[model samples]
Target chain A: MREPAPRSYRAPSTALVPAVELRGLVKTYDEGELSVPVLRGIDLCIEPGEFVSLRGPSGSGKSTLLNILGCLDRPTAGRYVLGGTDVSALTREEQAWVRLHHIGFVFQSFHLLPDATAAENVVLPLFYAGVRRAERERRARELLERVGLAHRFDHVPSRLSGGERQRVAIARALACRPRLLLADEPTGALDSRTGASILELLLDLHRRERLTIVLVTHDPGVAEAASRRIFMRDGRIEDDARA
Target chain B: MAARVLRRHPGRTLLTVLGLAIGVGAFIAMVSFAEGARRSVVRQFETLGTNLLRVRPGSRARAEGVRPAMPLSDADVRLLRREATTLALVVPVARRTLAVTTEAGRVHRTRVDGTEPDYARIAGLRFAAGGMFDATDLGTSNRVCVLGVTVARALFGERDPLGERVRIGPALPARVVGVVAAQGRTTTGSDLDDFVLVPRTTFALFLGATEGYSSLEVRPRSAALFEAARHELTTLLRRSHGLGPAEPDDFTLWSPEDTIRAAEETSRILGALLAAIAAISLLVGGIGIMNIQLVSVSERTHEIGIRAAIGGSPAQILRQFLAEALLLALVGATAGVLLGVGSSWIVAHAMQWPPSVSWRVVALSAGFGTVVGVLFGYVPARRAARLDPIVALRRE
Candidate 1:
C-alpha cells in the first residue's frame, strides 16, 4: 500500500530550530508554607531527528522534566522553546494547542481508553483536531496498519494483549503527525521479550519517519537504545554523552 | 462513544431510566384521568341540555348561624312566570320521600317528585310506555303518577300496570299514567331512575301545602337566550322576595353552562396539583441521574486525563459527558411517555372511562424531562471538565 501523505502543517525547513530547548528550568511544589523543589537549573537542547534518553533513578525529576517538555505542565522558571517557538509564557490553553500540534506521548501503562476500539483510540487526536469523520477513520486505519494492528482495529483495549495495546497507543500518539514523541518508561509494563520488540518498533519508526524522540527510563538497557543519553541524580543532570 | 460509555454500565443506566419513566407515567395517567373527569362533567351537562336553568331557595352566601331561608312559594313561582319575559317555561317541582305499595304487596320507599306537565319536557324525560299526564289531569289535580324505571321495576316487575292504582304513602292511591325511560344518573350523581312523578296539586293535597315549591326547572326558548333569561329570573326573584340592592339575593340561579364551567375549572386545578405531585418524583429521578453521573465522572477520571493529554479540550470533555447524560434522559423520557400513555390507557380501560391524552401534556412532560437532564447533568460535566490532567492520570 502507498504511504499516506502527512496532513499536518509543517514548519519552515530553513528555520534551523532544535526540536526542543530548555534553559535554567526549575519546578517547585508549594505545600502551605513549605516549598519542595523537583527540578533545579536544567538546560538541554535536542535537534530534529535525534533519539535522546533521560536516565535517572526514582525521585531524580526525570519524569518532571519530561512533563515540562511535553507541555503537560509548566516550569516555575525556564526559557523553553519547541520547533522555533518560545512557549514559556503560554497559557494553559495555549500549551494545550502546542501539544495538539507539536507533541505526542506514550506512557508505560499505554493509557488506552478501556471502552474504545483500537481504531477509535487512534482517531481521538484527529477528532479533537476537527478532522472530518471519514478522513479520521481512513487515517486511523492506516496508522493501525502501520503499527501492525490492522486486524485488531475493532478490538477494545481490554480485549487486546499488552503488546497489542501498546502498539495501539503508539498509533494513537502518532495520530496528529506530531514533531516530538515523549515516551516515559514505554517498556516498563512489558515482558523483556515484548519490551525488546517494542524498542525495535520505536527504532524502526524513528528511522523510517525521521522522528525526534525523548525516552525516559531507569533501565540501562532501555537507555542504551537511544543515540544520545543524559544521566540525572538529585534533580540535576550529572552527565550527557552520545554514542 | 457516549453510548458505549453508558453501555459499559447497563445496570446504572437502566435504573435511572426506570425512575424517570415511572414519574412521567404517573403524570400522564393523572392528566388523562382528570381530563376524562372533566369530559364526563361536560357530557352530563349536555345530556341535561345547556339551555335549562335551576332555581333553588338559598343565596350563594349564607352565614352558619343564620336561620335557613324559607322555601320558594307558589306565589313566587306565579310572580316569576308573570315577570320573567325571557323564560320559555317554568316547571315547579316538589320532592318528598314516600312509601308506595303495589296491589300484590310489593312495597318500597323512594323519592316522589311533584311537578307540572311541562316538567317532562324541561327535564328531558322520555316515556317507555303510556305517556305523561296532560294539562287536563294536572289542572284537575288528578290522582295519577309516572313511575321511573327503578320504581317501576320494584313495584310491578315485568308486568305492565298503565292503569293500575298504587297506594302512595298513607294518604291516597294514584293510577300509573306512564313509565319513564331508564336514565342512569344525573350530572350531580343522583340516581335519576329511582323516583316517581306526581301532579303538583295532588302532591300538595296529600303532603299538605308547604311554604313554597322545592325547586323550579326553567328553560329558555334557545340557548342564546339563556343569559337573558337567567338575569330576568334573578331580578324578578330578588324584587319579589323584597331584597334591597345592598343585600344578597335569597335565591340561587344555576345554569347548566355554569355548573359545567365550575366542574371544568375544579378539575383543571386538581389536575395541576396532581401533576405537580408527580413532578416531585421526576425531581427525585433527576437526583438519581445526578448521583450516577457523578459516579461516572469519578470512575472515568483516567480516561478524561488521556483525552486531555491527546488534545481534548475542556469544552469537548464537558460536551461528551453532557451528551451522555442528555442521551440517557431523552431515552428515559421517551420510554416514560410510552409507559405513561400505556398505563393511562390501561387504567381507563379498567375503569370503563374514555382515555383522554392531550398532545400538549405529552409534549410538556417530555420538555420537562429534557430540562431536568440538562440541569442535573451540569454539575458532573463541569467536574469532569475541570479535572486536572496530571492529577487525573496519576489517580490510576
Candidate 2:
C-alpha cells in the first residue's frame, strides 16, 4: 500500500490555528417576504481535540449552528473558519468539497440509508473521497469494529436496532478520517440506557483518537459529558463554561 | 446503490420497462417488415434480369379530356430492331382478358398475353412441361397457346394439357402447346401464374387488324449496355414517329434499376411515417419513466440528505439516478428487440412472407430507447440533486 499524502488545506503551523473559529456568525431563513433570524451574532473558538457541546432548547438554534459548523449550510453573515480556512465565503460546491475532506456529520435520526448494509453505509464517504474499493471496504470494516458493531457489518439499517443504527452512522461519519466530527442530537431518539451507551462510545472514541467534537443537544446531562459546554437561548450564546 | 434503490420499487420499474419494451418492439417490427418488402422488390427485379427495359405509351391531357395514349405499332418494333445497334431482341406484347373453356366445358377467366417466341427468353420464363412455341408455330401463326401454371391447373386439372385444345372467348379454339413454370407473386403484388401466352398474329386476327401493341419489351446485349440501348431506342422511336424537337416523345422507358429505386424511395417514406408513429408510444413510455423517477426522488428525500451530508456531491446524486434510468432503458431495449423479432417471425410465417431483421434497425431502436431514457430522466435527477440538505433532513 502507498503512503497517504498530506492534506494541502492543513496549516503549516497547526498549533496557531484553532480547529474551529466563528466571528459574529448569523443565519436567517426567508419565507416569502418574511425574514426569520435563527442564529444571531455567535462568536466562539474551539481548540484542536476539544469536545464541545452546544446546549439549548428546541428553538434555541443549536441544530442550526451545528449545520453551519458541519458545512451543510452557510452562515448568512460573519466569518466562519474551519481548520484555518475561511469557509464562510466558499461556494456551495467548494463547501461540499471541504465537508468531504475535513468534516463528518451525524444527524438526530441516524439517517442511515435503509437499503444499504452497515459496512456499505460506512464506505459511502470514502467512495466520494475517491478511495479504491478494496481500501474503502477495509476502512469500513475497521471503523465498524471501532464502533463495536463488527459482527453487524452486513445488516442493513432496517434490520438494525436504534442504537445499532446510531453506531453505524457514527462509523460512517468517521470513514474519511475527518478533522472535525459534528453531531446534532445524535442520541435524541434512543432510550436512556442506549443513549448513555452511545455517549460513552463517543467519549471513548474522542479520547482515543484525539478527535475535535461539536455536539448539539437540549439535555444538560448530555452537555455535561463534553469537555466544554456553551448554553444558548433565543439564537445567542447565554453562558460558556469549561470542565 | 442505484440498482438497489430501483429494486426497492419493483412494480414501478417493471411497468416502466414494459412500456419502453412495447414501444421499441413496435418500432423494430415495422422497420423490419418494411425492409423485408424492399428486399423482396429488389430480389424480384434481380431475378427478372436488370438488363431488361419496358417501353409504354405516355398519356397527355387532350381537348376532349383524358384519352387512351397512342400505342406502339409493328412498324415501331421493326424500326427499333433495324436502327438500334445496342439492341439484343425486342418483343411486342398486347394483353386482353379472355374466358378460356376446356374441352370438358370448364371455363376460367384469365389474362392472355400476345408476343413472339423470344418473349420467353427475355422474360426469364421456365417450362414445367412442354416448351414454349417453336419457330414453326410462330412462322405459320398456328392457333397454339402457352398456359401459365394457374391457368393450366384451372383448365385441365390433373390431365396432360400439351395436346388439349381450349376455346378462346367467342373465337376459335386454340391448342395448348406448352405449360409455363410457376412464378409466384410479382413485386406489384400481382399473381404471375394467372396468364396465358399466344402468338401476336393469332391475337391480332381475333382483335382485328387495326389493334395496336400494348408495350414493347427489350433486352440489352449486356447489363453494362442497358442505358446506351435505352438511349438509342428512344432516339430511333422519336425520329421514326416523326416528332419535332419541341414535341414530347410519346413513350416511357422503364428498367429494373429505375423500378427498384422508385420502390425503395416509397418504402423509405412509408418506413419513416411508421417509425414516427411508433415514437409517440416511446415518448409516452419516457414520460412514464419520468413520473416514477420524480416519485422516487421525493420519497428518498431523507436519503438524499444523508448522502449530501456524508460528502456525496450533487453531480454524484444526479449520476446515480441517471444510471438507474439508463439501466432500465437498456434492459427494456434488449427485451424489446427480442419481442420484435419474435412477433415479426410469427407474422411472416402466418402470411407466408420472408422474415427480415436488420442490425441497423435494432441498433436504431436501442439507441432511440437510450436517448429517451436520458432525456426524460434529466428533470427528476436535477430535482434530486438540487435538494437542500438542511430542509431535506428536517422532513419527517
Relative to the unseen true structure, what is the C-alpha lDDT of residue B265 in candidate 1, on a scale of 0 to 100?
98
Q: Second chain TM-score per prediction?
A: 0.83, 0.87
Model 2 has an lDDT value of: 0.85
Error of 2 at A144 (Å): 2.8
Clashes per candidate (backbone, < 3 Å): 2, 0
Off by over 4 Å in 2: A1-6, A9-16, A30-35, B18-34, B50-88, B98-109, B152-177, B202-214, B219-258, B275-288, B336-361
C-alpha lDDT of residue B293 in model 2: 88
lDDT of 2 at B306: 80
lDDT of 1 by residue, B1-396 (tens): 788888988998999888877777777778887887788778878878888999988878876654466578787889978877788998899888889998888898998888899999998989999889888888899999999989999989889979988988888699999999987765456777998899998999986766677799999878888788888888888788877787787778888889899989999999999898889988887887889999999998998899888877777888898998898889878988999898878866765556688888888887788778768998999999889888889877
List lDDT for all candidates, in order. 0.86, 0.85
Candidate 2 lDDT over B151-187, as tens digits, reads: 9999888888999999977785799888999888875
Give the number of the best model, judged by TM-score.
1
TM-score of chain A of each: 0.94, 0.94
Residue A135 alpha-carbon offset, candidate 1, angstroms: 4.2
